[model samples]
Target: MHLPEIRRSHIAIAVISGLLFSLSFRLNQYFDALFVYSAGISLLFLPAGVKLLAVLVGRLPAIVGIMVVSVHLGASIWPDKPMTAIVYFAFVSLMTYPIATLGVMRLFHIRKNLSNLRYHHIVVLSVVASILNGLVHNWLYLAQGVTTSEELWHKSAAMALGDFMGCFVVVAFFHAAMGVLRSARNPQID
Candidate 1:
């Protein structure tokens, strides 16, 4: 099977995204500890938002970066875990953004340029992505006997909420930062 081409720019994006993911994840773990409800459940997962932004901008290459980092992180965090389990987790995490983005694209008929993208499109994407990530991860947990049925729905809901909020906060901050930069570059006539 033919693989997607990976150019220098893609590599650059991947490295940058991977670094950002690492930073965001560590920060989230350190500062959002109080918000953590369970092993994979948190109230404000900043990395989720960072992941979304990287996927949006870097596309497939970014996914590759995320995959690499996820595997690395998983392996490092669970050093005793088997290689197979770590790979599995990475695969599952890697699938979330692409599926959500493709689904949103097809559902909304958005162009590659995203010329028609709007605020609602982002909202829809964030919601769908968060739900998919939460549900898929929780289902895996249940299947692995890590979580019981009684805890599944609530855990999924909490994870989804965290993912959505993370995406919202990161996007909002990026937008505001861009606005400030623009204003600084071009001061309004008094």
Candidate 2:
């Protein structure tokens, strides 16, 4: 595709991904830690073939917008800490995927295939995203004074394990769904 076409496609992907992220987050925030899975699934599955830059550019605004809306929606939930919750959500959202991608790139040596949504790329991404999602989030919680040093290591590890497991579950479902959908559209190719 030409530059203009690629730009539009990237924007469209971001917007759609953001919408999906916000919707998932909004509907499931009450679940607390479960939001990690929703987040992993939302952020990873949508922009598979898009470059990381495009995903960031597209989803950041949508996520921020969702965060802003949450300030109002969550006012009733955390009457005293709505802003805190909003800011935490925004910060975690900002930190999770980029850090995860970086970890995958460095650890998996898959930097060259970032633009392609191959199986290995998805696996590495899901693993990295899950691990970082837990670390960044629990570290934030620790910073916020929710956990003391005594529990930091174990707590973070447990959360990371949960996030990774949840990511794989969602990944399996989405991967299978994508295969079915693609096969339906391209029966001859499949």
Candidate 3:
């Protein structure tokens, strides 16, 4: 595709991904009693998976969408938080996927296109991403006095578990969908 076409497609992808992220966030809120673990953590944060998938497929531009939605949602989610804290968490959310992707890619020597990616790779990435995300975000929250040191580890674990479950669910569904597509494209005669 030409530069303009590529840009348009990337923009479209980012918008769609952002919408999906927003929807997931709303759904998580709807089931807040079941999914939420703390002020900023969910027991099943589907947006974490959406963020990962967007970066995996859409590259850097995906961050734009995720960041925008994150900031917007962060304000409403934690209205008492200062704008700086909201922005800070938004950035942390944006950084999570790229950091995880780069680390996983470098460690595994996986290709950028992820053509050689496997379920194990995804699992590893999810774990690394979730841990890093939970730690960094909670650390920042602690620094900002949003969370107490006593609650740090518990909050971090909650966040990590939520992110991991979200990533797992999304990746599993994507894998199954791809399998169905592949089978449809090359069906066997009985």
What is the C-alpha lDDT profile of model 1 across 119-171, one tens digit per residue? 77778878998999989989988876767999999999999999998887875
Score candidate 2 by lDDT: 0.54
The whole-model C-alpha lDDT of candidate 3 against the native structure comes to 0.84
Q: Estimate the TM-score of every prediction.
A: 0.86, 0.59, 0.91
Of 1 and 3, the candidate ahead on lDDT is: 3
- Residues 132-163 of candidate 3 have per-residue lDDT tens digits of 88888889889878789999999999999999
* Cα-based lDDT at residue 42, candidate 3: 90
Q: List the residue pairs that clash in candidate 1.
A: none
Model 3 residue 6 CA deviation in Å: 1.1
- By descending lDDT, how would the candidates be arranged? 3, 1, 2
Can you write out model 2's per-residue Cα lDDT over 50-162, one digit (the tens) per residue? 22332333445444444454444446544666577756655564567666676666675654434334567666776677667656766766676666778777666666665
TM accuracy, model 2 = 0.59
Model 2: weakest 10-residue lDDT segment is 42-51
lDDT of each: 0.84, 0.54, 0.84
